[model samples]
Target: MINKLYFTSLDEQVQQKAFRAIEEEQRSIGYYTLPDQDITPILSYCDSIPDMIETIAVIGIGGSSLGAKAIYEFVKPLNNLSRKLYFFESTDPINITTLLSKIDLEKTHFLVISKSGNTVETFSIYKYIYSLQNDPSAYTFITDPDSPLEKYANEINASVLHLPDNVGGRFSVLSTVGLVPLALCDIDIQALLNGAQTIKQSFFNDGYLKDTLLKKAVFYAKNHAQFHINCIFAYSETLKYFCEWYVQLWGESLGKHQRNSAFHVGLTPIGLIGPKDQHSFLQLIMEGTRDKSVTFIKIEDFHDNITISDITLPHLETLDILNGLPFSKLINMQCDSVMEALEVQGDIPLDSITIPTVNEHSIGSLIYYYELLTSLVGELIDVNTYDQPGVEAGKIILKKKLRVLKK
Candidate 1:
């Protein structure tokens, strides 16, 4: 596998729970199977895009935008893409105004994605954009087949990409949600899916699960209560948005209430960029309360050979040791040093995952790895991993608040 997982191991029982999760998920419309989907529709739609379209403004939030954003950010540099992909996900007027100022509506293609198709902030943003360009061809709606957004798209003769009703927004990345934007940007989405398939197939195989996925899921399940926070220290800046997507996926999928019990359960997820945050959040993880489970992610080969200059100033003579060293080496060294320090400090549950490179394949493998881990941990905790009742309740409340404001 291009993505390698390293961690401390656990007992058979926990591993068995992970296996159970895999079995259960196999029967449902779980995201793990998404890699096996035929993406002809996504590709065909991308092929039909007019050559004059220079920008793709994705209108979505949370699961809707994060996965696609993660994909674009992680591997855009690897491919020579000419079209710009922007996100219009906020209700903040300044955010909308700033995004609007960047692109010409005439040359921009909009992808309005909302799983429920009734997302308040999503449609609110879309409504404003609609005012500027009501041309159906200028927009594509990615939503559930019969959703209000889909109905509206059909009425306007706008193009439509359907999300499987069972697939949640966070898990819908391998679906049309992420693939459409990625394919439009000239990304080899099939390669991304193939990478995910490699992991998924290996995971389902008898031998591969024991060492990697099982070890990870079991660690979180066994230590969920004691280690209340799960933090990811991703070393590469390219992984910044990937960490954000992980936060949403891990936080929302696992956090839940059990109807039979009085206590609410979930691990709070924190995302930090390493070397940068090593100066900040790493201190808290090192000496603060022993309530966190940390995962350190490093890219083995950044594929860039930029190096520090051999010249050193009189006052900065101490930094001369790093002169001529590749920045990639320095960053990897920082990641390794941090992992070693964490190991020495002890008590905190820590693991490391190394990716050979930040290509579509490795990014795809990493995405499925986290998604599978979330499912496994949820199984062990006995929570409904696929649903977000708490979030739904909040959405209901927001609608009422908006109605009151309108009155």
Candidate 2:
């Protein structure tokens, strides 16, 4: 499988900075340590034979749910899926009402994921679903060991999977948190892990400093001053969720105050779909301010290759250029057309990533790519990438506001 990645504007200095970050990541314990781990536990637990689950609903938000959701979106239509996958990510009442109306509590299994057991959103949604479950035995928990969530799962006799305490929620996708949900959906966990392993192994190679992840980390760090925002557009429908997943991954990891300085280091990531955005957001991105960099992601191959038959109508002779146009080709042409237009008129810098096909392996490789790349970007920017102290500050605010409601 050829994964064609085009990253722009990287020099030797950029490569050097990213290489140092990769070195630091190599020495780490939790996230960078995933490639060496096994996937058997999550896979075996989610197997179809004994459980025979018909649906899996993941209840969580941000990193807790996005990674699994991204992987699911990419691989779902590609596979002859036996089980359905759904998500309850928001405390928004309309979301809760609409999702609850659709699920059949009997055959639907639930995955309640939280890195920390205390997220109000996760538990609130869980409480709602748990109240409705006639067979709560199908519920499972993915969280840190000995966390409140794990303890609660134990009290309910629900199956509990522990995440490494040091692995942040954003980086927990390759771990049990994401794999369990994916395994439940009949995805190939082994191949996915193998793909991740490929990238991990690449880091130890002869030209490790010249790797794609390093190049990307360098690109962001070097350009962070002017291009404060990273605009990601996914051309494929299957990749729409990947864009959302990257938002959390890039924003939370990089958005941090500099060490003992008045300044903060951050990259604001905004996700958009391809041609749709070409109509809506492109107008602004092309002619608007020059403070953003754009990344375009396109899947190289599609399953359906039906060509459009030539159309002949009374006044449509001008449209004959569209004869024998495969819908796939048309989609690709639209992507290229937008890219050309941007290149011609826009000042936004660009990166293009082309995956050979949308499958477990390619998707896994992508997860690893961003995880490692984000870590490297953190290093280049000279900040602690792992911790989310700002996020905690928000939670503290939430606690006080929530307490007032009870009083």
Clashing pairs in 1: none
Q: Write the per-residue lDDT of candidate 1 for residues 1-407, one digit (tens) a residue.
A: 43344456658876876697578777775576789988887788898999999999999999999999999999987678879999998999999999999999999999999888889889899999999998889999999888898899999898998886478888988889999998898888999999898778888876464357787777777778889799999999899999999999999988998546767899899999989998889899999999998888889888899999999889989989999999999999999998888888768788788888879999998898888888888887778888999999999998899899999
Which portions of model 2 miss their true places by more than 4 Å?
Answer: 1-14, 134-136, 207-209, 345-347
Compose the digit string of candidate 2's lDDT tens values, residues 1-407.
Answer: 23334446548776765676567666664888787777766666766324656788899888888988999999988689878889999999999999878877777888888888889888888887777773547787888888888888888788888896478898888888888888887888788888777777776564342465666667788889988888887888898898889989899989998766768879999999977888798888888888888878777788788988877777988888888998877888898778778777646677777777878888888788778778878888877888889989999999899899999
lDDT of each: 0.87, 0.80
TM-score of each: 0.96, 0.93
Best lDDT among the predictions, by candidate number? 1
For each candidate, how many residue pairs have backbone atoms clashing (under 3 Å)? Answer: 0, 0
Q: Which ten residues in a row have the lowest lDDT in candidate 1?
A: 1-10
lDDT of 2 at 366: 79
Error of 2 at 63 (Å): 1.1
